[model samples]
Target: MITTSRIRVWDPLVRIFHWSLVAGVAANLFLTEEGGTTHQWIGYGIAGFIGMRIVWGFIGPWSVRWKSFWPTPSRLKQALRPNYTAASSDNITHTTLGAVMMLTLLALLIGLAVTGYMMEETTRFWGVDWVEEIHEVMANALLLLVPLHVIGAIVESIKKHDNLIGSMVHGYRRVQIPPQHMTKHVDDRA
Candidate 1:
């Protein structure tokens, strides 16, 4: 229940990207009506934001780095069980499920954007029923996954003793940082 204010943990760019994607995905989920130009635009925006995220994952803060998403079998097992131990401050980032969701949503959003673009073009993929169907399926999956994402955030906030949503907005967390392993300057210096 501690709420100590701290320096920025989520960089401003990361915060903006996070919220933009959230808004875009939420809009994309509900605006699928025929001739919904706004919805299509939002999907494109989400795709762009996701692209930014992929780049950011490569070059963003220590917390949001692509290495953070690197799949570790041990971490995946820990995430699957209830006895998962929180990593040090340096290791504090998406867990296995979080990484999977990030990848899934990225693929789905990109698929939607590419299909939408192709669907509009006169050549190739245009008027292709299967492409349109895949787009719809991915959109529906996004709608289903978003609520689960929210629930996961809530549960993680409670377990980790930090407000996950608030951290994104204000860019900070109050979790205890483990030593030894966190002191490696290899990644930080690169």
Candidate 2:
């Protein structure tokens, strides 16, 4: 059995943002009445959450920062390669594929929010079928992407030997440190 140490990866803000967004999205999709007051408020809340995340991505901790996991060409290639090893240094927090997924979801949510708001305008975009169609398409895309996100998280948790779902909830991850890298102390009685 391999022993590991727990590290604080996701901060409170990040975790809250994640679950809050999930609840908001789920409520908007499944529970809330479409085009109703509750739905519009939830949509606005999601927009606000996304806006905060954008700002936080710049000033957040190393784990949540965009620079830490942004999908560069090299990183994307490394992540997409077959039989990739998670022990590598590049596999710290978010994988390249995870980065791409995050960005795509954010874009979709933003588009959905914009179109939804436009649909409610009833003046500038009144009777515009395209706006409603675009909103539905984005929502459907989210239905597909959310499952992919969950599957990817599960796969990565198993591959990395860490409870990623728990980490998202509790903001911690069990990190395995190499034996050689463990701190050593010298004895004075030589």
Q: Considering every candidate listed, which one attains the maximal TM-score?
A: 2
Quote model 2's TM-score: 0.88
The C-alpha lDDT values of all candidates are: 0.71, 0.83
lDDT of 2 by residue, 128-177 (tens): 99998999999999999999999989988887788888889978776665
Q: Against the true structure, what is each candidate's TM-score? A: 0.80, 0.88
Candidate 2 RMSD computed on C-alpha atoms after optimal superposition onto the true structure: 5.1
Clashing pairs in 1: 57-66
Candidate 2's clash total is 0
lDDT of 1 by residue, 1-190 (tens): 3223333457888899888987777666655654278876787777788888888888887778877656578767766777655432234567678778777777877888888887765478777898789878977888888788889888878877778889899776655543433433223321
Candidate 2 displacement at residue 101 in angstroms: 0.9
The residue ranges of model 2 lying beyond 4 angstroms of the native Cα positions read: 1-3, 87-89, 178-190
Alpha-carbon lDDT of model 1: 0.71
In Å, residue 171's CA in model 1 sits off its true spot by: 0.8
